[model samples]
Target: MARSLLAGHRLQHELESAVDIVSRASRMAREIQKRYCDATQTVGDATTLAKADASPVTIADLAVQALILGELHMLFPEDRFVAEETSSSVQDERMEGAIRTWLTQYSTRGVDERVRDSIDLGSDAGGCRGRIWVLDPVDGTKGFLRNQQFCIALALLVDGLAELGVLGCPNLSAAQEAERIASGYTEGIEGEKCLTIVNGTDGCVFFAARGAGAYMQSLTDRREQALPQQIHVNANTDPSWAVMAESVESGHSSHSLTGKMIRILGIRQRLGVDSQCKYGLLSRGEACVFLRFPRPGYVENIWDHAAGTVVLTEAGGRVTDALGGELDFSHGRKLPNVRGIVATNGHMHPAVLAAVKHVLAEDVTSG
Candidate 1:
């Protein structure tokens, strides 16, 4: 029924169009990804590269945002876009120069005036009315800098809800297994392994519309012309056997608290990764749960989780705030009304969320 609804929705055509757009943007970003990671000379050696050279991530971020917004705007002139990068915040002339050369060399459609000019498309204050596009051009700068895991997240929202989502993971591969996640990645790049992860050269794309279910496909390789494979959350009813996916950076989520929650829930396995690709991981059954508890006073930007929500939910998973509140995407750019985030396969959500609530409540009471 959901698959049929994916085609029936008024926005289905737009969703279909986005698969190609996101795939192209993802490949373009991969070009910049190589340069960004190569700056470190050796992978995972953050000390080797100076902060001054770190602007390539920004270059990729801004350029990709522009490319997506530019092409989408031309196609849907009346649609508004709310993206992550803006001209006011772009103070790096060197980065601007970098994008000019980068886009000229790597962009599939070639560099155009409107691409850079569309940088401020983020200025629009989106709300729950009509159709709007939300995008995080480059979701994990750290992951990109390290050449590990990163994604280009884009979504189409109608009346404040994400109906279509496209997650372009330039590092994730379509060949995934939950066993590696359960035991721990011991074998690929930089010591910690991702047997199914792609290098900077090629990647995968995960996409879905609300009622259409989720799908994963290969990216950057034209000869394959591979058909997308439908995906689903794993049926891991026991929390003890569950594998959780979380942020690679402890700063983004409180790992100490996460440790407590997983321990309480009997989940022994965890795979720390960057960006919204965690959503893809869950949707494709590589991982069973995802949890994040931001520091107090922190609110998530819409672009951070918008695309991820649809991908996971459509794959028979569930998403809600820490207290199990439905995620609210109507209040412009930030999820001001929501706190934290929890995602799991439908069978695991109830147990995992119960544990999350108990641990958090205990922490609050102790504080």
Candidate 2:
């Protein structure tokens, strides 16, 4: 009994520390967006470049990563980390200076070495043996640039299974969302209308522990709502009335395949957004399903879905590959074993899985 109590205490302490670190990182990202990503600009004024995979990397990505990893190092120096952004992505002197400027907001350490070391802390190769912290400093950069939906995702994996997850959706309005849900406005609501009507504000932080359920709080809440409102997936079991959520970027997922699956399942309402905010929406029962069938040969990164997966599952939702395989995150930083991603409120997961297989099988036969 003593051992069990001690273990529970330790888990609670770790979760509290994680929430603090992620909240600080989220605030820093919001500041950067306000400064650089205004209405006049599509992409933030921050310097941008392409990675080896041809994906966009911006100053906020590096800065938020540095802030989160740096804080984690201070809190738990022994833990390993895997993240998406790297110091090498910052090439020019001006960009380096921009990163340095952001670093000063978080710490008083030396600018040059601090920035590089903090970002490089994420270079560790993760495996199934010990504790690892996975981070996506800024997921959905295109959404961030356009001032749309984007998130700062963080997760802790113990022995390769996600035990804690935190996501900061800068465009999500928690108070408004609760009001909408309470009013039974779950269908035929435009995504933009949801954003504008509910608080006209951005910023919500959702988090979960392995066994404990998922919960959310507003970033702008100065008083820190004493107890976060617990969240759960929708209870609707009928497939015909389900609402689907997918990425707004067609390049990230196969639109044709998703369309076919939607039709097959008789889903009529669809919401499109950028980032793992889809997972946030699902957790709060704002959407019933999330489907992402990445293009052929595109491997899903662990950081992209790890935090979101835990958040959804803890909120009475289920996530797996399109073929119903568990997402394998033990190999390294990438989910080499996952072919595609599917998420839904628990009730409809099996039905959704059937539709996924049917659509893919049709593709195989037609090809």
Candidate 3:
């Protein structure tokens, strides 16, 4: 009897542990977004010079990452973190002093060192066998610099599968704002003076855990809504009529080749965006398909897709690697050891898979 009681308690504890990690990740993202809001006030504007990688690194990313790492440590100290950016980039003789001095103005004392090291973890390439946290402190660096869309993408991988993901999109407006922005109907905006879409004037956050459903929420307390209305992709199966989202930056993906395939399938409307916003859009039923087909042998880091994949899947979408293998985040820091990614509302997934298989077949025959 005592053994049975202990087993039940242990199972319950594990289940709660999963939920807590995912929930805290969402909270951490929200905290980071809030910190970004505060940092931008002091940084003047996000128009900083580019890094050697030609990517932008504003005070926003620095502050937010530090805040997130601190939160992760507080919430789950034992988990490993694999993130983007590193102290080395910030510490460059050309940039370190300026970066450090600038960060001091807005950040707490501890934040300086925390940001430096966490980013280094992002640059390092090891640790995937155990539980880990995959983080893209700021996924769309260019977008963030341009004052456009970007996301704080986070996911939790146990063993090798991603069991939870949380995405913070600070610029997204709520449903009410979305409607007003689309219709040009903003007589008395309720929330803060942020972007307004047809939905609402608040920022958007996406969260999902395996087995649990995906949900979206307004980052601000504008209308005090619960979250995004549960979303999924469109059901149209005719390939030609499909609409898809491709990386706005061609360098991040093989846009020309993806376009060729889109053209081949006769897909007409293609939307270009950054980060996991495509996944969020897909979940909301705004877009039906998203394709990230980079070079033939390119591998994607887990942070780029972990949260977005789980969110889309929980929302009733399907995501797979380019070769149609499952994207098992359980494997570690990188994804299921494959190239590229594809996500769609499940209705058109089979067709997409068939098309991809056909393309690979053609490539092989040509080879």
> What is the C-alpha local distance difference test score of each model?
0.76, 0.78, 0.60
Off by over 4 Å in 3: 1-52, 91-115, 118-128, 176-201, 226-228, 238-241, 330-332, 360-367
The model with the greatest TM-score is 2
- RMSD for each of the candidates: 4.9, 4.8, 8.3
Better of 1 and 3 by lDDT: 1
Task: Determine which window of 10 residues in candidate 1 has minimal summed lDDT.
Answer: 186-195
lDDT, model 3, position 89: 49
Clashing pairs in 1: none
Q: Is candidate 2 or candidate 3 better by TM-score?
A: 2
CA shift of 41, model 1, Å: 7.4
lDDT of 3 by residue, 42-135 (tens): 3333324456867667655554555555455655667677776555445344454444444444333244354566445444343547667777
Worst 10 residues of 2 by lDDT: 190-199
lDDT of 1 by residue, 1-367 (tens): 1233366776767876687778878888887667556645344232122334343345677778877887787778899999877764445565566656656655455456644577887677989998899999889877787777889999999899898899999877666662243223322223222222334345788888888788888885765644678899999877666777888776788777777777777776678888999999999887898999888888899999999999999999999998888887889999986767999987888888888889888988999
lDDT of 2 by residue, 1-367 (tens): 1122224654676677677667767777777877777665456445567889787778889988887888788878799999998889978778878877777775533334567788999998998989999999999887777666789999999999998889988767776343232222223332222111122374788888878788887777566542467789999877666768787677888667887887788786666777998999999988899999888788888999999999999999999998888786788999986877999998899988999999999998998
User: In candidate 1, residue 109 scores what lDDT?
Assistant: 54
